[model samples]
Target: MQIVGQTTQLEAWVASRTRKFHINEILIIEDRDHRHPKAEVIETRTFNRYIPLASEQSNLVDTSVLEGLRSVGFDIEDEEIHLGKLRLIEELPTPIRVGAPARVPSFAEVEDLLIKRKPHEGLTLGVIQGSREIAKDMPESLQNVALLFDKENGVGEQGGVPFVFDYRSMDQYPHIGIFGGSGSGKSFGLRVLLEELMLKQVPAVVFDPHFELTFDQEFPNLPEDFRHSFKKRFVTLDAGEDIGIEFSELIADDIVSLLRASSGSITDAMETAIKALHKKSDSFLTYSTRMANLAEALDNEKEIREQSRDEYLNPNDRERVKLLNDLLVKYKDKVGGFSGTLRSVLRRLTRLEMEGVFTSAGTKKVEEAFAKRQLVVIRGSMYFLNVFAFYVVRKLYRKRRDYRDSIQKGRPVEEKFPPFVIITDEAHNFAPKGDVPAPAKGVLKEIAQEGRKYGVFLVFATQRPALLDDTITAQLSTKLVFRTVRSVDIAVIKEETDITAEEAARLPYLSSGTAFLSSAITGRTTAVRIRVSKTTSPHFKNPFEELEEGFAEQDEKVWEAVLPSLPIDASNLNAYLTEIGRKVGRLLSFDELEKTLEDFVDQGRLLKVSTPFGARYNKA
Candidate 1:
């Protein structure tokens, strides 16, 4: 027989049953009378301390028992109750100031008797009928009770063990959210989750600003053919990678906005540029060759080969031109309808999705697998100025939506995208407030509102719940609240959560990694400690240090050489001419200017800060 620890049992029971089950106190009463130490005094509370008495317990003070007194109503004084080891306890007589000596008892007397006899030991058992209440013998370590949706063996009536949901269940809703603070192991957790998604045959598009989750080095030892094929799918966008652009597929608006440019105009420019670049690259074969050549050139020369050895010069435009020239050479054959090509490419790139595909080789013996299984690790360490995490989340949302729209409809319910779960690490950013056009906000809200029907679930992780939107904040069915130091966030969580007032005050003092999981899925809330992830072997970390230590020197060198040549004088006519010339050059597509200005106005920037007053020049 397995002798389970009382604390572990208690925790499991409470967490399994109630969304608010938590341990208040556990006193070990060295029950040396028995060979082992026994838990004598255990104090526990439900999510909402509204404890209901059992029918057996309530019968002790039933109306019939109270009205059967011999004497009429008499005001009673201090009273006591005595109980024998065998029979139940009876109430002691209460002395009256006057006549009858209170021969008969009132309801109060009977109630007091019942309270005293209410089994402090054997007879006192807290039976959890369903997943709501805790049995008296229930131990004290359970946490995170939830109404799980099983996709495999199916859900049972009650108290039965849960079965694992099949992988196809995740495709129903591919969006996921995860939140955590500094050193919270959020990245490690995400990596593991991604691995699970991939193994299940789900395709993924990841934006890794930190670069911790990208590259062959991060995910080692897989099938070389499969790994290489997957690698080709990655389209990195940063200053580092050769073919990589700085634009984001998730929030095209956000990325362009960061450039302090107009979203509409920038998006148009991006679309145009991508198509033009692709078309300008010769043929399919030539395009592939040139792309390879550009990648090689960037990797080999490290810097655009210097045009002059004697004269000091900046190499910015030289590198850009070289890269453009290389791209042209590659896509030279497919250059005609470049704009259309670009639009299609952009659309294809943003179709981030997780789906099950048939993997067994032969046509007859085909097996199912998940699509969108690639692991994306953006170079996040680039700069906090670039919201890489936000960028990735937005992209992920778009992918999920696209996948939902695709597929042959009216098929068997199970055959379609099965239920998928999304877990975001920095949940606060995904669900923020106050009139910001953040892509994550809309996607999170959409999932929160409609995900359940689609089997798309979300897990939000955040150190500060207060920063989250109230609607999204209020809808959390399950919550894992860790140790918090702020009063406001704690109070907000308490007010927002279903836990009792007593539990709120205790939230801020929990030990590190110890948290309370509360939700309607569980009958009560429970407090528990989570095991931390291992970080000794190959680990993922934001590449901030590398850029600072390794890349910064190189970036600075490149910047220095380039700064001297461009027009910089604020008052110089040439500066004005250059600025106007650049603006006019943009007239190659005048629509870009109008659209950008409009977008700026919509975002409150154009209005808040008037356009710089300058002498206007009209091009002849």
Candidate 2:
């Protein structure tokens, strides 16, 4: 250790004999009072005094004088100095006077600072970036306590340190935000995190619009020992397969929001009609049946009231009259004019019903997953995702909140509804900052504000941070920011995170799989390379590769299915297509079959000719 330069409480400049000091390297400065203040090297520079001196004093200094100085052991040309600029990790208890001795910390001291948390204190996310000495000294307990990812320590020739995080701290901090541009490893990092959660048996619901989170697929290239049994813990609720929510569970507001998302805005009359209908009926089927019956009753009553002459009433006629009168009175109080508004509301509801969203059967209750600690993946379109996410999030969040409240009050709580985390990949769609609120925005906002107290957390991942709701963004306790090219997004990240100007500048240039993690749990902003995922999405394949392998097989099947249907003689295109449709058990439109024939003609597989009966096609 040597005192070479100036020192202060927060920063210092140190001169060293060797240029081995690395960026992000930690150093200890000992004051005269023996108080050791830790500092991290932020910048490094090499100094050569001879170059400046030779440039400025060329006329004053002669070559003979330089040679004489060199002979007398005053050779400035042979001298090189290493200078490091360091930022203090914490304020010194006592201000260090100038010229304090700065020295590299021993492995044990660095280990204590980087690892060795109290038992059950925190989960290891990964080792500190760029520090190999600290990486090798990480405690063995950290390996099993946290999900570990291998990262290159800038100092070493081999082996990586494990980066760690205290997942339990999320209970206090609440939510996490993952922001990155396309191909920035945002999705990949999310998979890694989810896998960790799975290993820990934390229940999660993932809203996957892209249908990518099929955890059944084994992690490619992973050792058997490292692979996880996701099939037992993962459940996929596929929208295309008609998995949906129970219509009886949806209120009028949910219907209105679903309508607005699927179609457009709803008028006041439409809203009133929906609410009235919902009030009258117990379920979707009941609502539809009652509305149809009410419309018929009103029509019959109007016809009878407008009759030119009164007819003698029989017993059946009297009962019919009484029923019509009763129906009119019941609906008139609920729906003022049930003609136009009811028709419009029913039409929209019927359309939603036909879309297979409001179903009694095949409803996947999210509470089931919470009870079992399984990862429930709801895969669907944006519209379905919006509506379903709203319902599930609202229901689960309230249940968890109520359960916690019940426990606090010494009341009976449901054991099935436990603490859970909700994850959304395209989170901006759910909690946007725009004027048109997403269907899930309100519930998501509520959870973001108060979910922490109830053991509910949100992991919102999006490419655009600026578009996310400010309340949700502000509530996020941890942010894993990947490479973002948009200046607006970068500005938002810089404002929200504790990253230095240097780190902010590096955001655009950060390599894929690398991110800047800022969290209250870590108490500092760190740049980390997210680990490789053991499990991958089912659709993780190159389109070109898939097409290359599939095209020939598909072409052969199409030819085999079509050739037998073709006539030996010239036949009209429609006739040939009809025959092929019968053989295939599905009919192709005239335009579709015509296009296929035209392609075959171009490929010399068919011959087309103009005849009196219009175009005629034959096998070539």
Candidate 3:
């Protein structure tokens, strides 16, 4: 079936490569030479499918050619799949003299030729079952289609041949972590990958800190239906709201871990205390035992308020005291002696009513708010802190465990606990590797170790990887590395992620928005040019640009907006010196300290007017 007048390069290559056995095609990497244009042609014949030697269990027989596949290696008893070559056909016109032609020969159409090649019951030559047609009902607004690749599609070329690490390959390992500097386009890249999975109906949860990812409006210009579908699947958590769960559902270990308490009898007491804290049937004594640790904090507010009342008796202080009194009265019974020393302390501390740390009304409102929303946003609130992150994570874990237990017990669990994604920004603040407060460390460790299976995924973003928990960092199978100037952080990332030294060195120089994307999902070690997100507004702006613009403005814009935010009363000379010392403690070098002080002076916040003994100080 060789064509009559075609060049024999493809045929010759096939003959040379498949000399010993039947091969689909010989794939050659096309050259980019332009001087001799024809030299750029690299013709390779490809097979849709090839029968390689296989064992009882179907695994591909290893060969020199297959070794090029990175990460995944070949096994015996397997089938070999190859890419097919694309042909450029030149359709010839009717050659005969029209009026006097011996016969009007009907030239075969490409589609008909393909159909004719399907020889009954025998090996059919290269033939397609059907052509892919654009769906007539598809809306014009939808601009992109999901890319599908199967055995027949062949290898796609994206400058070079495109490769995919099949889902099957990543089955053995599944944890993932992403890291990048501010405004590095990590969010955009993550969205693309997530969308791909959603289309496949692979259940996934993502914790988004900035609230940029959860809102439908966040991804504008998308087809309405597509947006709706994505939104329906997401569950958001807000820190402002009180997320509720049955205390009894949580295991003692989980409760202890959530609070970052040390494992021992203390944890047991904490767990017991948490379970008894808000139970309807529990006695005041039981309540006290559960919340005893913070009991003293209850009086802290009343004491402060009473002092304020005696000193200033302002209307605000009066109202605060009234609120505190209401809270104390409501929970006074629960403030009695508890089991564990810490539990008892917490119980007493939490006894303050409206006049206490959390007013009764405030607690109720917070709880009610969290219970209603599927997707919650916890940022942009003054109350949201490192402690808050721990609380939310712990709550979610407890709820998940309770749901599982209910299912096991054949109890009616109406609301399905949807998978959640936890995106922690400035993760070091909550999951610091070294001596951080106990609660943050405990729950974060639990999430890292066990959350993946329970439908919890963590997106930990940090500039300082060296300061992050080693255990949590190690569990991430996917890594997105952006520019990191610190050698320590770069080294930590490289060592943790198994990135080569050459690649590690390049991290410090990565251009803004450029990152090294490594995932088990895409095994090939290749650099990807991230697609710019057209849907979402560019909320993540350059901080330096914002700062420069803010400071450069006149007419009190800078004074009103920036001046009040500074810790020092630049007008007060004594306060300026103390602030400088405090700020300088964080600097890596004395030169930076000096430069910062000079900048402050130049800004007129620190006046450089006079000196004692000719030693000048930056006077506010």
Candidate 4:
């Protein structure tokens, strides 16, 4: 390869006759005075001299007309030359020498430039693009550190250096955002990231609104020795079952937030009713009771007044009337409103209760997971998680922040809470861009801005970057952008990250499992193919594929029960069906057994014979 064109300090063009230049491949330009400045190929092109650049011209001919030249031993591909445009990684004060030699650098020459840490020291994400050539020369520890996945093939051999991320650097540059469209490997990349975090034993809480974050199952197609089981390293918690909010800990704003998230929006009168009736020590039962009572009081005010005055009323009825009168007199000025407003607030509180948002006392299970340094996967619907996350994130963040603050000021600490990370999918729903009122958005925004100081960070992945909150998006110092076809999302990524125009233009065409990692930790953008995950979600199989596999499993079960009794006479098939039915957990009819035997015969597993008395069955 040679630098054939005029060269500048920042940009140059390299031409090769035999070798194809790859984008993002580092090249050392030969110049003794410049000390071989390193440049990365940003663009590449290949073309033949025989064909016109514009194939739509009137002089154009079909490719079949060119086939005769190949028979004469003239190949058009041999006339093709590869060209690459290079950008210096670090710009120099002066231009480079013209017509200088350019060559690939050895692993040692660019070790410091390419990787910041070894495989064991950082999160091994995947193989870096353009590193396949130099990976062979790398040390054994770095050589086969990761396995890549392909659709046509199973797991491909490790062909490049692993992209080990320095997660410790996240303290300096806090939150990580993953953006991509559907089928862009957005969720696949997230699973890989969480697996790495579990491998590192980073305490985390993953809000799984999709119910697809379980990691107990091992991944298929992995090498025997490389397989890992995270059965003990992670725990899955169902909302309202394993974890929930302690209603007593909530303030008026907490109640308002949860109510707003549950009902989409609350009226001003409903807000006033909540603030007036809810006390600092109120639980869900107490607060909801007060609202219901106020609405009931408004409905039966004249009856209650007359009942309290009537001497014929029983003592219990008189007591209930007296309390109702007192409540009406007490909140007459503060909660003076229609009964519908009070009923509206009561309905929202009841809805949250039915969904088990306040069924449990607290999130002690999540805290216990954190204390053990375990990854706690919290599963719930989008609405449930949104309502619960506001309470959970605020409580845990306050715990960590308070502990860290106490140590910094030399105050006595009452409790011990570890700093942890918060990860979630469908983050745009929680922290949406516009005025969409979601309860979780406020605390998530708080953690995005100030959580790093207390050793708390966020990993938010979403398909819609344009819909994610601007404040949170701006705080995301590291972003993994996968294939996105939407122009609006692409524009947001271009403005948010340091991706060059060339890379931005190629976003719609990137394959699955590939992403452009723009990180402040690396101080540059890297094209990366994500590594295979150690575990997959339980629902990873396509529903249609599951149907076929389910039938096969059922067939195997039935065949196993009948295999030992093979070669029996078809005359005794009824007796055999009764026994086979007991083993397969279902009753079988005579016609069903006859049809099954014929299927086995057609499949070459068995043979049917014509006997003098009747037909007979035998193994094939």
Candidate 2: residue 353 lDDT (0-100): 81
Query: Residues 1-620, candidate 3, lDDT per residue (tens digit)?
Result: 01111122321111112222111111222222211011111123322234433222233323322332211332322434331211212112321111110111122212222122122221111111111111222233222322221224422211211112233323244455556655555565565545444434444334345555543444434444333344543444444343322333334344444344322224444445454345554433444443442344354645844554475577886665665555444444453433344543353334321112222122233233335433334443322444345555776676766777788889999866655556566676667787655455677788778776666666677777788888888877767677777888887877776455555766776655456656654442334334333234246445798787765553133233324334433234344444444443421234543445457677676654544444343447
Local distance difference test scores for all models: 0.37, 0.72, 0.43, 0.85
Query: Looking at candidate 2, what is the lDDT of residue 57?
Result: 40
Candidate 4, 1-620: lDDT as tens digits: 76654567888777666899988888999988889998888888765766564123223422332342343333445566566878888888998776678999998888887889887788899988988887769988887678998878988788987899999999999999999999999999999999888888999999999899988888888998679888888898888878888899999988889888888888787788888887887988877877788788889988988887899988888888888888898885677747888887887788778877786558888888898899999999897888888888889899999999999999999888887999989999989998989888888999998999999999999999999999999999999999999999999999999998989999999999899999999988999999988888888888999998997787778788888888778888888988899999999889888888888889898889998878988888
lDDT of 3: 0.43
The digit string of per-residue lDDT tens for model 1 on 1-620 reads 00111222121111112122124322122213222221111123222112233212344323222221112221111112110000001111321111111011222322221122222111111111122222222222122111111224332122211111123322332233333344444454454444444444443444444445433343333323223223433333332232122231213344333332112133454443344444331333443344445444434442435432314445775555566555445554444423344443333333211010111121111012213333333333323313333433434444444556554353333333333455554566556655544445665687787766545566666667778777777666656566665777777677766655645666655544345545443334544333222111134323686666664464334334323433222233343333443433421123433343344446443332322653322211
Query: Candidates' TM-scores?
Result: 0.37, 0.76, 0.44, 0.89
Error of 2 at 214 (Å): 2.2
TM-score-better candidate, 1 vs 3:
3
lDDT of predicted model 1: 0.37
Pick out the ten consecutive residues of candidate 4 with the lowest summed lDDT.
Answer: 54-63
Query: CA shift at 288, candidate 2, in angstroms?
Result: 2.6
Q: How accurate is candidate 2 locally (lDDT)?
A: 0.72
Could you tell which candidate, 1 or 4, scores higher by TM-score? Answer: 4
- Report the alpha-carbon TM-score of model 3 versus the true structure: 0.44
List where candidate 2 sits over 4 angstroms from the true fold: 1-9, 13-17, 32-34, 43-84, 93-107, 111-113, 116-127, 139-158, 223-225, 240-242, 293-301, 307-338, 361-365, 547-620
Residues 44-89, candidate 2: write the lDDT tens digits: 6554575676424464344443443344344345566555767777
Instruction: Kindly report which residue stretches of model 4 are placed more than 4 angstroms away from their true locations once superposed.
Output: 6-9, 54-79, 307-315, 542-545, 560-580, 589-598, 606-620
Highest TM-score model number: 4
The list of candidate 1 runs beyond 4 A from truth reads 1-379, 382-399, 406-421, 436-439, 532-620
lDDT of 3 at 163: 19
